[model samples]
Target: MGALADNRRFWLACNLVTLVLHAFGVYLYASEGFAHPVAQLWAIVLMLHMLEFPLAFIAVRERRIGWGVTIMATLIFGFTWWVPTRRGVFHA
Candidate 1:
C-alpha cells in the first residue's frame, strides 16, 4: 500500500485477517487448555494487539489514517471501524 493517502477502508479491510487469526487462536487456546504456554502467549499477544483499535480510532478522529497505519492494521487486525479518510471514503 502507498503512504500518500489516508486509506482507512483499506486499513479496515486488512484488519479482517486479525479476526480470523484471533478466532483460530481462541480455538487453539481452548483445545489446548487455557493454561498451555502457547495458548497463554497467543492470548497475551492478542490483548496487546487490541490496543490498536483505540489508536485507529484516534487516527480517524484526526483524519490522518495514513498508509502506515493502514498497512499495519491490515497486517494486524484489519480495521475495526470506518473513517472518512481522504484517500478512503472521501478519496478523489
Candidate 2:
C-alpha cells in the first residue's frame, strides 16, 4: 500500500512537471515559431489534450476507462518538450 501511494505521488509530480514544460513549449512555439515537424507534433499533442475532455467525462461515469487521460497527458507533456528541443526550437 505504501509503495503504491509513493508511485502515485511520483507519477503526479511527473505529470505536473510535464504540464508546465508543455505550457512553456507552447509559449515558445507561439512566440518563436517552430519547424514543420515540431509544429505538427505540437498541434497533434494539443489536439490530444482537447480529445481528453470527452474521455475524462467517460471516465467519470466508468471507473475502468483505463487511465487514458493520465497516460496521454503525460505523453503529450513529454513529447511536446522533446519534439521542440530536438528540432532546435530553443537553439538560442
Candidate 3:
C-alpha cells in the first residue's frame, strides 16, 4: 500500500476523487442541509479536514509552500496531498 501510494497516477486519482466528493458534499449541504444524513456526514468529514490544518502547516513549512495553497490542498485532499508532498514522492 505504501508503494502504491508513491505512484503519481495513484495520487492524481485520489485527489480527483477527493475533489469530486468535496464538490458533491458542498452541493448536498447547500441544497439539503444537515437534515440529510449524508450531508451531515460530509459536514463532519469537512470539519475533520479543517482539524488537520495545523498538521499540514507544520509538514508543509519545511517545503516552503505558500500558506494558501497548502490550506486549500490539505482541506481538499488531506493526507493524499501532504503525505506524498512530505515524502518527496511528488518530485522526480
Best by lDDT: 3
Model 2 clash number: 0
- Could you tell me the lDDT of residue 84 within candidate 3? 82
Native-structure RMSD, model 2: 12.2
Across 11-42, the per-residue lDDT of candidate 2 in tens digits comes to 45655765665676677688767754555556
- Models sorted by TM-score, best on top: 3, 1, 2
lDDT of each: 0.55, 0.50, 0.81
Model 2 TM-score? 0.44
Off by over 4 Å in 2: 1-6, 36-40, 62-92
RMSD of each: 7.4, 12.2, 2.1
lDDT for model 1, please. Answer: 0.55
Best by TM-score: 3
Kindly list the per-residue Cα lDDT of model 3 for residues 1-92, writing each as its tens digit: 77886788888898888888778878888998878777777777778889999998887778888899888888878878887887777641
Residue pairs with backbone overlap in model 2: none
Candidate achieving higher TM-score, 2 or 3: 3
Single out the weakest 10-residue window by summed lDDT for candidate 1. 78-87
What TM-score does each of the candidates earn?
0.44, 0.44, 0.83
